[model samples]
Target: MRSDYKELDNEKIYLVTGAAGFIGFHLSKRLLDEGCHVIGIDNLNDYYDVNLKKARLEIINKYDKFKFFKIDLQDKEFLEEIFKEHKIDIVVNLAAQAGVRYSITNPDVYIQSNIVGFLNILEVCRHYKVEHLVYASSSSVYGMNEVMPFSVHHNVDHPISLYAATKKSNELMAHTYSHLYNLPTTGLRFFTVYGPWGRPDMALFLFTDAIMNDKPIKVFNHGKMKRDFTYIDDIVEGIVRLLNNPPKENKEWDKIKADPGTSSAPYKIYNIGNNKPVELMEYIQTIEKHLGKEAKKEYLPLQDGDVPMTYADVDDLIDDVGFKPDTSINEGISKFVEWYKEYYEV
Candidate 1:
């Protein structure tokens, strides 16, 4: 039997920056499966385990359609070469210096990747006239908002961390390109995304590893935090759905009564989250249930550059993309646990 994917138009190339990272790796593999010609770029920085990133690349290299570049997004000249080579239809900028805590320690990496690197992407897209540019934003952008389920319309002026500020900056930069150059752009504010091939720095991964090794897991904020943990597969689904239907100018958009989600320009922002907040302790308990071992938890106050919780209102993503994240924490964690045991031969 044939797969659901049809052969892609060899004429069209899609550029996915940060191709080796968690989200980028998943997106690139999905595009390749659909027979899309994907041009993946990543610096392959050691911010996490390089072996894990290489593992992801190994899976993608199996598909004949993918071509990867070891180029950094900060390289402007290299950016020009790529834009000139492929008739790139879409650009998904997933590459960034991730981690809020790390951002506090090393601010330069954030500036280099998030600021300088993103600027390069914007310029490349603008100059080459790419049809669509979709970049990853984060729920951390909802910093200091007292709202339970954070809405996109709410003002995001008070960013709690440098990482959140950069994500917010990305949205603003994307909008500028959309507004000025007529670039169709969509910024995705991904919630606490966790699943197979997930980042090692994330809480779930860290907690699981520590428990198995009989090490104490750092329970931050005294285990009082909550997060709308959207599974990675759900995030990819929302992204692909939106990719098929790019954002367009809202004809009915009014200047005075502006909806922050949509704009007069061909720009949009959506919260791709589970829309259900999971408490920290409950999440750990679920992990413990899967591993059959109680975690040695060391309670700590909320670290700087961290928020108490993150809960996204995914109403816009559902209304626009026609679907929202539906994976329950139990199901998601089970899958992750299974993958963990198999991947590590535990």
Candidate 2:
């Protein structure tokens, strides 16, 4: 399906919050490479390692068309200043206090960054007349659902963690703006994303780091967890395809049935996942295969705010964008390990 907005042009400015983040950095770099003007904003918080975030910024800074802003989304005044200065055509919000477990203790940060910060973004978009707003949602929103493949069409009323709840709230908030102000919005529910320059809190990085240091890795959920680990490049591709294609009001949307994915407003949701679920044990084995070393595992029960499995139903993504995440775990792991070894000089 063609996008309702005009075709993506190099002259148009794209505002990408969390540009120093894992997904944000990659997406910004890709746009800069395509000769697009990008206004990148990131707080560079010490959520993980600030140095890594700075390193990603260094790489993106080389592009002449890319400009970086050291501002937080919570800073509404600064965000407004940016909007006034740059005629941003599109806004992709990837900045959030991520991590389900982290939200257990650091709930305030999540509220401030994800909820309050998102409100600021929406208000700015509404006033500025931005063409499209695409933000990151999570598979954790499917909490307590036992379905085989989690679909956007499924009701996600039960969110287990504060982080998931905040993401679900983002979808609702986007819908409200779309309904009331005619702001085009799309929320992408990304599965387990992993690749080079991935977040350290994620499984792929943690497992690889511990194994290389000869430390026993904590195997959560008694090593029975399953995840639809989507590669970074594939996730970026999906976002790029949908950047111009803002959601339109579903003419056939039924208020009585109330499909959670679509709305009468210009709002839509999609799950961008590999669509292939892999066992946690098998995922670890793949890392071991690439590193040529076995990891000492300590089996533990499931931690708080974690689900047993996550399998995404990307039918909407494929139907709308004509693409699906196809990168295999082996290839993705190998690439990450290669980068890990070189980055740390291991």
For candidate 1, what is the lDDT? 0.89
Best candidate (score: lDDT):
2
Q: What would the TM-score be for candidate 2 when compared with the true structure?
A: 0.98
TM-score of each: 0.95, 0.98
Summarize candidate 2's per-residue lDDT along 93-190 as a digit string, tens digits. Answer: 99999999999998999999999999999999999999999999999999999888999999899999999999999999999999999999999999
Candidate 1: which stretches are off by over 4 Å?
1-11
**CA shift at 226, candidate 2, in angstroms?**
0.5
Clashes of 1: 0
- Would you list the clashing residue pairs of candidate 2? none
TM-score of 1: 0.95
lDDT of each: 0.89, 0.94
Candidate 1 structure quality by residue, lDDT tens digits, 243-306: 7466788899989977777899999998999989999999999999999999998999999978
Q: Where's the lowest-lDDT run of ten residues in candidate 2?
A: 1-10
Best by TM-score: 2
- Backbone clashes, each candidate: 0, 0
